[model samples]
Target: MRPKEIQEKLNIDGDRIKLFKREGIFTPENPPSGNRSTNYTDADCEHLRLLVVLTKSGLTCSDIRKLQEGECTLEEAIKIRKNNIDAEIKRKQNALILLSELLADKVEFETFETDHYWNVIAAREAEGEEFINTEDMYGYRAVSLIRSIKCPYCGEEHEVDLEDYMYDESSYEKENGMGPDVVYSFNSEDGYECHECGRIIQIEGWIREYPEGAYDSEDINVVEGEKD
Candidate 1:
């Protein structure tokens, strides 16, 4: 109620509390006159608590004042803050995966790469561990690296044009590597029929070593046509 008592209860600087009051955040129930000092009510304490939370969410004093004036609702501020936090989480996750692969001592090139590497990194970070014991799996991944392959179904060799989704590690490792490799299942437009047997074929692919000096360019075209 008294400034000293309010400061102790709110664990805030007396001046800070005074500023909020002066800025019309919440007025004392009974105004202090002459020797009588200002005292806050239970409601005032609750308002101060909300004020502290809003400030911690990166709102300025002016923003809080607007909130008090009903310029915006608390729900709106909360939604905005949540969206910002989600964006930051995605950014950090991307950085963790990219930097880990790029800075690895011996990065491997592969057609069927797995996010097992990134997932392990995420798991280790969750436990406050930063060391990556095995960097064997970390590297850039491309979608359906096979330009053409011999089909398993009809034994026919087919030319393949893959979509971008084929290269994602999570796509292959979805459900812990139980999901089917999408590259093998292609439409007629994306995959050619086997000429020898006249059967529509899903070709098997391989993981090959990435060539040296391939990382220098923006677009690294490692594999082309069928690997003989």
Candidate 2:
């Protein structure tokens, strides 16, 4: 077939035909002498038409040539594109989870003292106020702050240590008040006492109030009845 005939059939210019030859999509042994040459074939024209369609569908010129040469398959190309999309989605999901965990940690850290008031109680217990056992009370208080605590029942005392006394927060609320904030009647007669002796127990809980000059460091040495 003539070059002019092939160009008319493919609806392309002479330059594009030369480009197809340079890309090695289809080659003629004898180069076309001039603008008009009968060196092109019907098969060559049909190949150029297919190349144009593939290139228009987002395939690069090199990729189109490779596909025509049987070096790669269309299914492999599609799989590569999909894999890139999947990787991008996974990256975004990981970023979201990281942000959520960071926000949760920050919020928990800020309310650290409020959540663990049991630590304060433990500190007092270490200072020799022996009515309440500190080790047992710490676990109960911590769990209570986070969830709930069981009442210090008499039946379970012989079987387990105080730390083992677990109860749901709802049950504790039903028996005792919600927390130390709410004032409730204490059974002074049946309240927690020293296990070693029959002495009245003095278990220190959270303190919500302080004296007017309680935090003043300079007044530390000032006694109530002493002159400066």
lDDT of each residue in 84-124, candidate 2, tens digit only = 55655555564456457557667455566553445644564
lDDT for position 186 in model 2: 15
Q: What is the Å distance of residue 138 in model 2 from its true position?
A: 71
Best by TM-score: 1
Would you estimate the TM-scores of all the predictions?
0.33, 0.31
Reference-based lDDT, each prediction? 0.51, 0.42
Q: Candidate 1 lDDT, tens digit per residue, 1-228?
A: 886888898888755665565456756676543223566788878878887777777665666777778888878766776775666565567557666776673556663245766686678669765443322234433333336555564544544443211333222324553333332222222233455654434333333222321211122222222333
RMSD (Å) per prediction: 27.5, 40.1
**Which sections of candidate 2 miss by over 4 Å?**
33-38, 78-228
Q: Which residue runs of candidate 1 sit more than 4 Å off their true CA positions?
A: 79-228
Candidate number achieving the greatest lDDT relative to the actual structure: 1
The alpha-carbon lDDT assigned to residue 52 of candidate 1 equals: 74
